[model samples]
Target chain A: MADKKKKKLTPEAQQYQSYQEKREVKRPIFKNCIKAFFVGGTICLIGQAISTFYIYYFDFTEQTAGNPTVATLIFITMFLTGFGVYDRIGQFAGAGSAVPVTGFGNAVVASAIEHRTEGFVLGVGSNMLKLAGPVIVYGVFSAFVVALIKTILIKWGGL
Target chain B: MLVGHQTWMFKNKPTIISTGTVGGPFEANGRIANDIDILHDDMWIKQDSFEKAQRTMMEEACQIALKKTDVEKEQVQFFISGDLINQITPSTFTGKTLDIPYFGLFSACATSMESLALASSIVNSGGANYILSGTSSHNAAAERQFRYPTEYGGQKPPTAQWTVTGAGCALLANKGTGPVVTSATIGKVVDMGITDRLIWEEQWPQQQ
Candidate 1:
């Protein structure tokens, strides 16, 4: 039978396995949540600051300023991605770095920069979408579906 | 009650035979750069990915630690290490190459001391004759995963901290001719009654 022939680890191997289990550190879920919460909120606070900039300086109302604010944030993020500044913030903030629209820009430009040596078409163009691929695909599809439902409600339901 | 409430003292003195440190260019230019055992001029370490480079440095640090002493990699009982990246991938991947028993740890900034303490305890307990304790963090890789890429020109506020780029490994043996591990007290868990209503409970409210 296979059971009789089954081999066991040598003493050293057994001890090694035992030590690995005994000494391993567990992930700190609550601590990480706190870090992510503050860092993420800070990123949002930056976004709000940018939105306010557009509203106060450009004479756009707060409600109307959101559109340009997102664009401005993404623009700043892209530049920060280029200048190597965002990364320092990301290191301290962790999830704070990824929770903003800026993070999406960072992801795209990061992969592009990482793969720049591979040439534009094959490297930057392709790799930029690699992480964003799923998000963008689902985003468009969901939007289309939602728009279709809205049209149906407005036309057929006569609401 | 003794020196500090958070510190624990190991019964046995775990001597550190040797240490291996690998630093990138920035650290190479630091005050202790000349003191580093091995220094790489480039952050990539000629690897395709920053994370991979971190792994290579960590492995090299371990190898150097073992090499400094008569102990072969095979003779080492275990590797206790981790990194700043998600999942502590660099340390875990290096563990794969070392092919020794490994305990992937993540204590963020304090990981180096944390591993040393744990290794001392294990060796002191007679669980093993030798253990490797270390941690590594790459400037570029840590930033990429946690913040922004190198190219991002975001202006850092005056208070922002910098990542420590390099790996530091120490070889702890039951008997050796070096500094010994005396005692290690674990950290304290403080609760300020900041409740579940705080969405970002993992982080402090104000940190730039």
Candidate 2:
């Protein structure tokens, strides 16, 4: 059905709906906000620490360290997902864990782990991207579009 | 092995005299809360670990059945119970407390029905007057074993089942006012080509 029709009032159905609404517990928005802030901030802090470490140890410029720092974060998240620790953090932190690139890495690795039973080709290769595919597609396409716009502005508008 | 699809046909009808059930807070908040004999406030059951909590529920369920019919612990011949824990420790520990002749079983979710079938066959054949058959699965304990830890907050796919943290036990005897078990059939293992773990987990329960 495209849309559910408005049905005639049944006394029992009305009573049941009312009961369900009454029993529903309200979500604590403030607590959730606090949790998300702390967890997301912690992830960013760790990323900054990694970037700083790379700049100092590898003698890299602040500009060059960004790529390696992201790789490191994703690497760390993948391992944590494998070891079954990232999921715990994800649970405790909710959106805090999800907003970071690490969460994306966790999602990809978690799906791979889940589908490992179906063999490498069909299971790991195919299903690994099942959850991560859409995000990646949009990311690449948007980046391409931005680059195209930049080129068009530089060419036609004469810088 | 001389067995060829061997099935047990009992001469006497085994009756479920009394049943005892215990559930976690999740089930207590569920629609069928009133149906459960005992609804626990928390999953831990005042125990230190999830494993121990599962054991307490299992033992409590048997105790409830025994208490309802005024049957002494010593009078009940067997404690055929199991839980979704490593080595079936909950059943083992509960058996230790009951001090009854135990047959610790492990058939995952099917343990409840399997144990009932086994107990009914034994009772019908004059093995014992009363036997307690029970099985339990703590959501935390099961998630820790078969999947990730409960604290992990891992998002499960739609096919993933919520492991019900509850224990249910029934005392089967030759005469009782409850439902009677006329016959029992042991199942054979059949594997289909369903490759997904979540799908497999969901399918196994439905098959039973």
Candidate 3:
């Protein structure tokens, strides 16, 4: 028992001693921070640019331009998702990109691809709703409830 | 998969439309001769709170979709549904309540389209006489998985698609005159290494 104890300590002490003897390489947190900042910032900037482009080039009103901008964003995201590039961005930027409308496209395409390996009927056909399923349910129900209220208001309250 | 064809005889469009009953009642609309039941139980919350809401919403949507399609509960050859929860609780509950040959699917926002595509294919191929495809999502449930809560006050960028907090249902039948689903071309998963670093920096200064 005592010998086993010494043997364990020997390896542990050697490991610790080697670690202490090695030169400590200081990694600047700012490097990753900077990378994240620029990469994240650039994505937002592009979104803003697209929105501005819709407003300027497409001559859309500020409010109306939003719709076109979203459309453009979705379109681009769909393309990126199709090419299998958005997933990498998602891993690097984390929630920064996945939280946007583009993420919706990613979720859709990712789930579809995941299911596709199962074959058309059982795979892609069924797995497409892996992410966006809840969005549709809430959308429809909320709209239905809102529509119900609107109907009540129109009929009785006279809005 | 069995390759077989079955056709039904109908005089008119054979379409059913139900309204004011969540989705609608096909029996009331005179589309289906038998009674099509709608089930909504609060007991689902105990099994899973998130799925409870989703099941409620999906049940309502299926009720409506069934009514609209004029398909009877017994007549439905298969039911397909999906949600964002584990094992797709919504779809499972839906399958249980309907008690028919059914399947549950998950594909995120593309669920409705996916379900419909499959239903159409099955009906067209004569593998099924009547098929139901449905998908549902809840805002609270989705936020927990995809983002922060609404109370989080997170600024939504212009790129976000306002999640439709509802469910959509469609019925496919060999007897209907509506456009048949001939073929479906599914979208593939593609990725580009465009970093969102710039977007994050511009949007959230505190994070920087």
Candidate 4:
């Protein structure tokens, strides 16, 4: 795609683009992946511990412990976001912090606090889902599509 | 007046008679804190919104510049300023408070220098006797406009710039006993066909 776009540029612009490309900073994708793996794994480990705790301490079974565990993680994330610590963690962890339920919590809480000055109804309430709204919309849509495919396979394609 | 294709050689040599610099807590903790005339303990500067805070800081910087030279607000003929905000509202509000004939510029990171250049050119050409040249930028306000909210969790590349929460202004005059502006060169836009907002990879030591 980039090459296709580059072909349309003027000779001077193309030359400059190539020159810039040589000097451009390459993203440390390998390092980021490693960091994300460890950090994301650690977050999942904590979530598992929370789930186990709910299962063992409370009367809840393994099947019913997921909701409380997610809520707990989000609550923790809300505190971290309010204290301005989660942003720093996010800077270090990249997608590790982002691709988790905690990240969604941070998005809502951060936007809420950020636009509070504009008033509650217009500012905090409306803009609260600005960042997380897309994630929710698409997440549910993708799940629905997957569920539809599963139902079609079960109903039409004999087991 | 016109020196080269993009340069201007000022004959009058407009002088920066006085200057005022305001900074937030982050800048206050920096090495050049001593040079800052007014350093606020908080980023908000007691304003309700970050935009309002930015405006207040700009006004404070302009006021300090005027006070240092004992120049009356009426004496300053022109106020040239800019910022990174959408529509440069902080600078406009500062102009409204200073109540001077205003010229709002938008040069992003180069706003301060651009304003100074224009202010000097105007004073040098006898278009204005006194000019206040300055720029203000709040980190939060700039982030809200250009990037994300202050509390948003996102990783920025090493080359990403931090929008400083501060304001600085210089009182330039046609005749004074201080640093003189001799020339000004306006920049030209050069597009390199690169659409990536984030660029500039760090060259390793081995490469160097």
Candidate 5:
């Protein structure tokens, strides 16, 4: 789709593009994927530990502990964002830091802190969701669509 | 005067009398820290915002540039500077504080050299007695505008370059005992037609 959208370029631009391609340094995809896997797994391990702590001490079941677990992750992410460490982790881990619930928390909190100079109402309140707003919107919409499909199939097609 | 299609050869020989460079804590710890005029341990530099901090750095750089020379602020005829920000606010605010005739330029990374060339041309042609040419940028301010927020968890590729959080100014005069600006060649914009920023991310890393 992207390739199709590209407009025709002049001969000079084409020559420059080819030259840039030749000189451009490449990214280590395999190494990045390994790093992402380990980092992502570590985040999940920490999340599981939080969930287990709640289950063992607070008398919460595995199903009920998920909410508090997610909340704990986000709270930790808030601290990381505040201390200016998460961005570095993000640069190193790439999808590892970004594919977790903490990444979502970072998204909202980072924008909020970044816009703090503009004031609370116009700055923090309005621009807080600038990055993560689309994710929430599409997420809810897709969930609703999936639920609708499930309901129709269960009622008519007998599962 | 224009010597060729793009180059300008200055016959009057505009000279750089003095220079001032103010850097952030990151640069203060770097290898060239000794070369910087003023080093601020804090990224904020005691300012309320990153933009304001950038303006403060520019102001300090300009002041230091003047203080290093026999020239006074009133003697400076033009202030040419710019930064990577919305509407180039940092440069404008610095000009406001200096109260000098300002020319806010925007050439992305080339802003410093562009301002210097323009200032040299003006001084060479006897258009101004003294011109302060400078440019500034803050990492947080630039990241917020060009990429993600300062605290955002979005990853930057290995090929990504860090923006320098500092300001530098040069005092150019027609008559001075310093290095002279003989000629300047301005470059034109070129579009390579590669719009995908993630193409670099797709390539396999080469072994060192």
Candidate 6:
């Protein structure tokens, strides 16, 4: 049986071997890097622009300007979420845009839209806070604990 | 975060004059003043799971304000705050914790700024002394009413903002020892008439 297995390959096997000879192509490294650099840089530039706008137009001090900038970004992201443009940006920017406050707005609006078909009150209204609920809960809870400690200290501790 | 509190010195102790909220009907208290105290107490709206958190944050902010100033919680003449939640839970909870003469307000996101303005005016006019004014927002609660939840992986637009999931409190003393609220400006709501709900496009533009 072992000697018999050494026979020459049939023509059918040779034909199959020839079919698998296609070459694999590689993407240009420079092009990929250039694209990444521009896209990433553009996001940073937008953030800078927002900060400047708040400072110059709103008369906000440098420190306080961050609030307005975040507000503006949120507003923009909300509109985009409604128009269905933000999802694409998220894909490209990865966490660049999603890590900010604007990302939170996008999550809320998008989820609302997803559940809108369920009806106004039950669908959209009920599901609206699904994504942002934790932030509110934790934010409030943390603050409450702080207040409790402060109250105790002021009331009895005399600090 | 600063865990400890510090006291400031002044020749005369500053008194809390007034406190107010924006998202409610105004009462006629005709008085003039040079400076006003305002707190952004109404900025956060409440939702079901967020009730406990809102109360907690309001209490913390108020505590910070009280601890920083010499006034005791009982000595506080009034506590003013508001939100868009049912019965104004944030403000109500805050009132219960502080256990002072309290007023609830509602004005959506503008609550905090509006409250600060009112507090400033009261302090300048000598209505009361040592007023505690503050505002808070919980992302979870506000999103439930206004948007969506965290489990959803839905896309977001560039314009939307993650509501600050935190609370801020300030002490309003008439003596002008600490940083005094200088002015409060009210902003009117404006709609840009954007009918396109799907403003953010879901696809990235392909590189040409």
Name the candidate that leads on TM-score.
5
**Which one wins on DockQ?**
5
What is the DockQ score of candidate 5, to 2 decimals? 0.48
Cα lDDT tens digits for candidate 6, A1-159: 422432344555444434532431333446545644665567557878989887888878989987777777778777888876776776455444555566677777877876664578998899777656666777789899999999999999999
RMSD over all Cα atoms, model 1: 13.7
Q: In model 3, which runs have C-alpha deviations exceeding 4 angstroms? A: A1-159, B1-50, B194-208
Give the Cα lDDT of each candidate.
0.77, 0.78, 0.59, 0.86, 0.89, 0.59
> In candidate 5, which residue ranges exceed 4 Å CA deviation?
A1-7, A150-159, B196-208
Candidate 5 collision pairs: none
Lowest-sum lDDT 10-residue window in model 5 chain B: B199-208
Among incorrect, acceptable, medium and high, the docking class of model 6 is: incorrect
DockQ of 1: 0.08
- What is model 3's DockQ versus the real complex? 0.02
Candidate 3 has an lDDT of 0.59
Better of 4 and 5 by DockQ: 5
CAPRI tier of model 5: acceptable
lDDT per residue as tens, model 4, A103-124: 8888889989998998999999
Model-by-model DockQ, in order: 0.08, 0.08, 0.02, 0.39, 0.48, 0.04
Please give the lDDT score at residue A128 for candidate 5.
Answer: 99
Q: For model 4, what is the error of residue B136's alpha carbon versus the real structure, in angstroms, after optimal superposition?
A: 0.7
Across residues B116-136, which tens digit of lDDT does each residue of candidate 6 receive?
A: 666666666667676777777
Among the numbered candidates, top lDDT falls to: 5
Write down the RMSD of all candidates, one decimal each: 13.7, 12.2, 23.7, 4.9, 4.1, 29.4
lDDT of 1 by residue, A1-159 (tens): 322322354556555555654764544557666876887787789888988888888989979988898888788888877777776776555556765677677767877896675578997887776545566777789899999999999999998
TM-score of 3: 0.42
Error in Å for residue A18 of model 6: 61
Residue range with the least summed lDDT across 10 consecutive positions in model 3 chain A: A20-29
